[model samples]
Target: MCRWLAYLGEPLRPSTIVLDANNSIVAQSLDSSLGAETVNGDGFGFGWYPTDAPAGTEPALFHSTEPAWNDQNLRELTRAILSPLFFTHVRAAAAPPIQQTNCHPFRYENWMFMHNGAIGGWHKVKRDLTLAIDPSLYPNVLGTTDSEVLFHLALTLGLADDPVAAVGRAIRTVESVGHEHDVQFPWQGTIAVSDGQRVWAFRYSSQGRTRSLFHSADVPTLREMYPDAERLRLFGDEAHLVVSEPLSEMPGVWVEVPESTAAILEPGGYRHEPFLAD
Candidate 1:
């Protein structure tokens, strides 16, 4: 299992969430209270779209095999950059070896992706799933983790045209391939994807149970609820976050994404839609 977060809305420093929050992503990497594994020390990755970059510019990436809390460079970089949308992931290796290529927030052109779950029976279904990726897109598959493969699989299945549909199809493919190998619950995870503008987050599994996933309450709502809290003053009304777990214990500040749902965050705000995996 892993822990990750996606942010959209106002332009702000990535460090505000990745490093500075009460239970920041970096803190989660070291001691996650809600993650399946408390220590996600395999590696970490951060991807962000520059605040004022030209349209279609791909998000910048920084990956390290070192644990997030132990990486000095990660500290320096996150503190230096500001982005309107960004992704940060802290990983805990299940079966794959820890390496930079295996880190999350994998990128393709203007799109970025990260995941916080696994494809059950990865070793049994790895070959079939890898071969199923479109031949043209297969060339871009750079890591051995199921996370990166799933990202390319989503791309091959048409993520660019319709991300929710593409991801649902990708999970179905994984489930079908897994069942062929006698793996009953083949998919388990929460996923986040972005095209440098909007963000799409999904929480689902082949089985009924899925990992924890939540999004921040609307900024205006938070402001009204915690009017005297100084931290609420840092964000614009449009600011939003989709994370594997709450970044803070503040009441009414995070909303749990319902099971089998896709949460989409765009310019106006965010909305939830049923995610059909079949």
Candidate 2:
């Protein structure tokens, strides 16, 4: 449905992955090889934590209804800013209207969230899901997309306490509500969330067949595998990325995240754990 990526590691310009890579996120916005829609031109969003900001500072965000490939400001901003952690998402609007509020990389305080899938039969269960959000947090819901609702739902269910469990609970809520409306496969998405420190990405769906998700291999390992590759020299050993699709065609560069799994990227490296497990 959409293409997105999350980066955590050394501080570097956002453009390195968003624009300068072989098949950058901007390129995916216009011609995604694996997305359900080839052109995700409805809108785009970028969020990043400033390298110099104090700990727990909120990440800055830039959103536009313009196509990612055609946005001049996006080009300039990504080039100028360097961040240790960031998120970029290009939207392919399904049933929602094309507007800035609906863009991805949705934020709440110091946290950022984005998604690359949809809730089946969203209209049938929209009311129930929205009403389930905690009233205190409900006021912060600024968009109509199921993605934003899912974020707030996670927050209400305790995203601040435990992201993995909160997200699991949120998806379960969506599945439960959708089942009441006869929508068989209610939840489908590869979601990424961060609290300005570590990133937690989940790949899951109610039907068991989920969207594509991958994380980059550790930099030291990549360096040893491809010693002569110039691109490999640019990143620090701590660099890691989790994306909807591989950013490059280099062999051994990206590893496919398993179905029903949560890939967590932290300072040292990354790891995978079963998500929504019984």
For model 2, residues 1-278, the per-residue Cα lDDT tens digits are 99999999999988888999999999999999999999999999999999967767999999999999999999999999889999999999999999889999999999899999999999999999999999998988998999999999999999999999999999999999999999999999999999999999999999888999999999999999998999888788999999999999998999999999999999889989999865
- Candidate 2 lDDT score at position 166: 99
Per-prediction CA RMSD (Å)? 1.0, 0.8
lDDT of 1 by residue, 1-278 (tens): 89999999889988888889999999999999989999999999999999977768899899999999999999898888878999999999998899889998999999999999999999999999999999998889888999999999999999999999999999999999999999999999999999998999999998979999999989998888888999888888899999999999998999999999999999999999999744
Scored by TM-score, the top model is: 2
Pairs with steric clashes in candidate 2: none
- Cα displacement (angstroms), candidate 2, residue 226, comes to 0.8
